[model samples]
Target: MSHAGLFISFEGIDGSGKSTQARLLADHLRGLGHDVVLTREPGGSPGAEEIRALVLQGDPDRWSARTEILLFTAARRDHLERTIQPALEAGKIVICDRFADSTRMYQGLSRGDLRAMVDDLHRLMIGMEPDLTVLIDMDPTKGLSRALARQTVEERFEDFGEELQQAMRTGFLALADEFAERFVTIDGGRGIDEVAADVQQVVSTRLPS
Candidate 1:
């Protein structure tokens, strides 16, 4: 589908500073006079947020990988229908903290090898990819430490430990390679202002004046 606005997504392991960077980009864009929609995954729209509570609260093994993917896809569908698409149609840049890429990394790499299932569901249910994907790349050790410091009810993903996080980092990098055109890997180890400058520079180049 064609859109007048841009769709940008941030992808990374549990705590790779992608979310913070996403917000920074949105703010920068808004400051430049572009209408910006700052949102997140598993729970962008109302219905999706409801699903988010369900999927996030339960035990880590409560849902099987197959079932989990189905739930995630369902939430994503709701998010797209209620939040993302409308904003894009209205010419508002949508900056999402996470998107289908998170599902691929978390579900396929961390949980189970159901990547094929994840891809099929996304293609069938949510057939759209972000116009630009900013992957805030970081060392798993550093990212994991940052993640663990944050206390939240949404500990399901973080509970996966550093090993899984390492795997996820690898997976994200591989995805960056696969979707190189839309994907930009920004080193997330630097200070926030420094990283934000690079992110803003990259996004400014892609976005229209």
Candidate 2:
């Protein structure tokens, strides 16, 4: 919708190096003559940070499915209003580690309606979508191994067993396929630098001159 700035999102299962790659890409973008802002979902703005803690504290039983989605959507609304929108309006490229796609993958696992809810929330809150979304792909077994290896703190999802984690991986890949045009699934099994290079290539090729 006539944005001079670009919105790029990185998505994947935990430990797929989305955060690291997001940072790397942001840095690379800034180096290549772009004003860049790096942020994450459920924790970008102050209000969202509080929601993030409650969401990750493993209190699923305390939250109904609708409640969980609503909390995430509320956090997203605040983040877009307070952080992302201003950055974009200022003509800064916004590279987000996770966005509405995470809600679809995490909350919509069993409840299909949750995906619709998240889509509606995204449209209402952000009023836009990423120009390109990169989904870092890795086997869940390997991803969890990496996740556990890097874990200083465990979130609710990190505690899930192989089965559920694998399902989540499947969900991400399915989404990549579903939104093929906006989605690019990178091979996250490679070394970090190698993956970073691949991501840089994608960014350099797409970024506006």
TM-score, every prediction: 0.97, 0.92
Model 2, 1-209: lDDT tens digits are 45667889999987899999999998888887789999998789999999988887764365666777888888988888888888878888999989888888888664345778777766776577788999999888888887878665435667765676788788999998898889998999999999999999887778777
lDDT tens digits by residue: candidate 1, 1-209: 67888999999987889989988888888888899999999899999999899888758777787888988999999999999999999988999989999999888656878898899998899999999999999999999888889888888777778898999999999999999999999999999999999999898888866
Which regions of candidate 2 deviate over 4 angstroms? Answer: 59-62, 110-113
Candidate 1, residue 197: Cα displacement in angstroms equals 0.5
In candidate 2, position 134 carries an lDDT of: 95
State the weakest 10-residue window (summed lDDT) of model 2.
152-161
In TM-score terms, candidate 2 sits at: 0.92
Each model's C-alpha lDDT? 0.90, 0.83
Best by TM-score: 1
